[model samples]
Target: MDVPGPERRLAAVLAADMVGFSRLMEADETGTLARLKTHRIELIDPAIAKNRGRIIKTTGDGMLVEFHSIVDAVLCATEVQHRMMRRNSDVSPARWIQFRIGINLGDVIVEGDDIFGDGVNVAARLETLAEPGGICVSSAVRDQLGERLDGVEFEDIGEQIVKNIARPIRVFRVRLQQDARSPPDKMADTVAQIGRKPSIAVLPLVNMSGDQEQEFFADGLTEDVITELSRFHDLLVISRNSSFVYKGKAVKVQEVARELGVDYLLEGSVRKVGDRIRVTVQLIDAESDRHIWAERYDRKLEDVFAIQDEITCAIVATMAGRVEAATHDRAKRKPTDNMAAYECVLAAKVLHHRSAREDNAQALRLLDRALALDPNYAHAHAWKGCVLGQTWVYNWCEDRDATFQQVAAELETALALDDNDSDVHRILAAVNLNREDHDKAAYHQERALALNPNYDLIVVQQGELLTWLGLPEEGIDWIKKAMRLNPYHPERFWNHLGRACYCAEKYAEAAEAFSRITRPDHTHHAFLAATFAQMGSAVAAAAHAAEVVKREPGFTVATYLATQHYKREIDRRRHEAGLLKAGLPA
Candidate 1:
């Protein structure tokens, strides 16, 4: 049954299906079907229209769509997912549904409205490879949109063999991040807006020190430098863990940039001999294959730690001052749901970061979906706990004690499933710190750091905890290190550094650090007031004290003290004296 006069040409095909449709139906078949129908009518259909997608055909739980533009096809898929997230927010996790999307740009034989042949099959196969609530695109789809997706990163998961396909397909997992150092978006107006940030990855230094014993030293040096480089507020630096994935393997810098979503690369080597050390470092523009900066350092190893510090300061001082401007363009914003339990968690993360009561509510709703989608997803459970903890932290919970208990239970589930996930351990660390369980907090913090030392949040949190633990000097150094790791970090980082500085009796330094905050809230003003008071500056202290009360009229030093969880009695007393001296109610 072949039709005559059929046209054949290149087109983009998008294949998508609801993940776990059968299980959802089994749980509540009739309700599930009705909800899915509503979703199709309200969300999916409209998005397809806006993106210029043609409806080809639909299976009971899946669909095949055709698009003239490859970019349209991919955008439609992400738009649909974004819409699904919004719709699912109103429902419970058990009723929430997610889709896995795959896209391929290849030639297809068109007969009437139906398309056939290798291209369609490739997209279908790609769909099966996508993490639920995630999209997978073939190399063809990726190649069609080049620099336009500069801010959008695709994690190359490598080649995969699919059914009914003779050749393996290279798959990339899309992940979204905002980097200020990246070039402007070059794609047409179809992609989402992620921050136009340029990113760089620093690879592990080769231990050219000849002695196998020096390998660890070389590795440590690389990590230290990465930590130092992360301080600039505008630059984006990939974590050391990600950069080290290519350790001992030769990789093209440009290829690495495409995979890591970084525009530049930093590679180096280290060698140490008797009382002497030599280091070589190069900064590369990955896209152009050009060396931006390269230097060799030769120093007598009078003090190993001192030499390392000197090198770190020299490099960070050089790079921190060189941030470039970037702009918005078409960006395929990748999502974050865990690899297996991808959908609900991805939506949850977006909601969680919205910093509002309603957004947190939506986040809880989506996280529930994540757990329903994959109850075995440890991160879902952990994130659920964190959300509950947030309710208490923000004073939104009806019963703080009950919320804390629930947080503990959820973390227990997370630890049981995968204690190795740095986030799980970090959340536990945060919760323990809140409960004043210093031992538990320290234990969890160490575990998290061990899991991913390059994680900026964990690194900064470690400093925060250390400062409270009466090691202000050490905490000051550590937090400063974290700032280098994430140059454009959140404002809270400076607050933590200021707190440590104030606690360590560095009054002027504390005021300077607090002053760096662009938007000072009541807490920032309160900290500044305390620092100024410590330095005996009556006018400056009084001004900040007045601002704090103006911003939070009911705030009192005692109330704030009760909320703080400083580990050392001495530090707490020191802070209280400063605040009280600055006219805060005792």
Candidate 2:
């Protein structure tokens, strides 16, 4: 009786069964089958083929297929539904042929022209979970859809305790509706509805150094200024993750407004050479793409940070004063026009953005230099502390605990000097998040957002914190807002978005988010692999798996765990769980 073996391979399994096939067949077997065959031949098969799907087998009332890409699966599903709706327009409800579809990707056993195992089983179970004439999918499928398909809504159904399964399966119901129409011309109404609080996005400063290496300096400076502005508690600054999306892109202000859902935009450029640096900046009304204010500063290299602070202060004062003057009566505050301390901080920003051990050391040195020039330079101290905290978290420092303590002390000093300094408070919030003080993190983050509603980095950080705190739906909203503000930001923003969706068990969305990153490293590649595995695309999973192994040899759960050092503990855990579920070692 020892005569059994198995065949195995990876594949994506898509199952579509008639919603009321039995009842329809009983009512009219020949008529129902005839219509089903006609629909499959005329619409479903064509749409599937167009989306690059392959039909594997078809039962009398159902069809099982596979797709090379999850995107294709979704597109096919959407097209199938749309075509079916069109075809059924003239038919009565009882006579119309509707379907419930499910899709999953994973490894499976192929036995004599048939598929078996969890991959097939999950797909079948998911199909059962689908609402009649609707689509249901595992988290894996959801991650791949990202923002490509608009107006499609999803509802989380939590973990499904499926029959014959040891672990509970998380599922989501997808709602497909007609595309959303554009909003009516409601400019006046929108302006009136705008609360007294103003919103803004800080676009990544252009690097005019003619050398790509200097990009980090420009980006770092922009991030620092955004962080500083976020402390305002009344301003709605866009988040860094969102604003950074516009890095290295020439975008129209009106388009930026429409995307970021903001009123203002801040753009700038940095030029540096030996012993000297020149910076230019401007604030624009995003709705009209009109420049409201512009400035330029030229100084010796040693005085860069001082100039940066002066410019930051001026920009904040000008923007804040304009809003306050328009809505209320308040005197605007101004900072001393000290060039020396500002220069030190600017130089430190250049070092910090490099994000390497040597560069972080240089940043520290420059911060110390700035402090020597002006002990009351609150922004410089706060930025220094923030950089130190990042260095510790990134494992660039050996004595991380000591470094964190030093950062805390510096942040306290910064706050003592200027309680209203939004940047200082934002750094403190990050510190609290790292310390697992989620409530404090949220409070401080909210305060920062209030001060400068336009600060993008703060928004991203807030979203990250929310995600960690098990408030993924809210986190997703914030992250989407950030992306709207800076559509062209770095790939990392998409990574954060993917992590959020994955945590929320929106697996298809997660996959779509991750796919947007053109080139991913070990962790990101692992995320992609796991997502593919969960979706039942073994081939894609294997490809990403090889990359993950190449990048992180001997990778394990511990290694995966070590990478979950987000500002918030909950976010960290959620991210880890996402990758783990996707089939990463952890």
Candidate 3:
């Protein structure tokens, strides 16, 4: 009973294959097949069923499954791996069977019982990319999983040139770590050891509304959640840049855990239609890939902040339990009573996050509108400070001093209104750093860090300030710590690290640090050029110099230094001199 017509729809595809299957078969074909059957029956099948996935087909050493939810597919994969590990614990190491799995979410052409198209091909390619006993996921699947799973680490393997695929496929490897079991300590009479607190990464919420324009709303909501949750001192929050790297990918929980060293994950999606918006959120155990909690909210566009608050509260509540009651209650305080003003602020923040000149201008305008609507809005003022600070730093404005003045005024007002706000402190630190008020910058940076020690951006900023203060060695140490906290940090962080290394006269390290960043922006290229020049690689320096010039035709040591918005005249002069020495023209 074969249907002749074509059936096309979006679906999550899970593909897995045994590692070294051919080699195992050559050694003992019958035994290998028998063991695989036993493993599938005893471990894989039940795990898949538990996660609500349907086994579609089996290809001797491989299996394909279909899931309605990407979360289920990831959970199934994690459980299967866990069970396999347990099963192999007692088996001989040489005889153990390991499987590599890949999950993808995309449109697939389904004809009766069979599936076809690039979706399946992507999944197969991912499976091939996965290391033995590891999981590889496409960007699509990772987006659907969202931030629900904590401590799952993802290593960006970058774009893969898959066979038959027109474009290179982005792949991520999920890092899962095994938990250690410890017996009660009886002989410890010395200082008490405080175990490290559990950590979580909130991946960027996917804009599932099909319209590309709704991306800002989704990203805004995600940033708000991150900000709200960061108020809790006990929980670690990965920066937007690091988590957003997993944007548009299918990732494994274990891999996420290993890469980010997080214990939990929170992922969600937003579907917006005019005045109405639907948000779906889930929290997952990164180790097990099991959904510990999940919720979906449908609300009017005006109530988006309320919905975000609720999601943030629930996640915090789950993590620290009743201990976070005060934190949860504090989170309920609205930034503004005027819904319109709040929406304006959201719009402004979304635009600001884009980091484009036009977007920053739009964001500043929206922030102005928000302030006009609600004069006493502390969060709006804080965000206004951020917008102005970013504008100056990113060379979005011609009058850099005026932008700094605006940032200083807005930040002071924000702090006066709500000194407890970590974001205000962070922005104030940036303003001070721009003014070369190193002491003040350090004070605000430390305050922000104290409010949320796990805030990776603040940590990075602190390192930057340290470097500007002539403490290049200390700056390198802090930046390295920040990198350790968020291994997948954006190119900017790596660029900062390279600059810090350059300041420390670690030219080789600087080159290596800059080399890690694949997406070289103007700043990255400038830093790479400087690093290569310092390393005596004139050819490499010339190559990156061309890239810098291409991005900013008028780019020179002076202009590049001016764009950085460094407050200290001494620091700016030193950096400019270094770049000039590295072959950058004045």
Best by lDDT: 1
lDDT of each: 0.78, 0.73, 0.73
**Per-model TM against the reference:** 0.48, 0.42, 0.42
- What candidate 1 gets wrong by more than 4 Å, as runs, is 1-373, 396-399
What tens digits encode model 1's per-residue C-alpha lDDT throughout 1-586?
8776657889899999998899999999998897788567646886789789998999989999999998788778876765566445434677779999999998899888799988899999999998867888888878878767544567788999989898889987665332136544643221222233457788888988787866776788788877765643235789888988999888888899899998778888888878788988888877678776677889997877787777776565444433231111111133433222344554565566454678888889877876765575777888898888878787777888888899899987876555456778889999999989998799789867765665566888999999889998999988988887666565768889999999899999999899888867788899899899989898999999999999888988989988788988998999999999998877
Better of 1 and 3 by TM-score: 1
lDDT of 1 at 106: 87
Whole-model lDDT, model 1: 0.78
Error of 2 at 358 (Å): 5.0
Better candidate number, 2 or 3, judged by lDDT: 3
- Looking at candidate 2, what is the lDDT of residue 506? 82
Which ranges of candidate 3 are over 4 A from the true structure? 1-350, 483-490, 515-519, 558-578
Question: Can you give the lDDT of residue 262 in candidate 1?
Answer: 84
1-586 in candidate 3: lDDT tens per residue? 9777677888889999998888899999998987787566545786788788888899989988988888888878876775576556535688889999998998889877888887888898889888878899998777766688765657778889987788998888887654325423531321122223447888888898997867877887788777767675345678778888898999887898779988778888989878888888787777667776666777787766676665554444344332222222322353534335555665675566556788889888878887776676777899998988887777678897777787888986776455556678888887777675767778778778766555566778878888777787998987877665554454568778887887777878988888887656777778777777766788888888888878888777765675465445675665666576556678
* Angstrom error at residue 432, model 1: 1.4
**Model 2 Cα lDDT, one tens digit per residue, 473-565:** 898998876665444333567877887787777878988999887767677887777677667777887788778878878888567766454
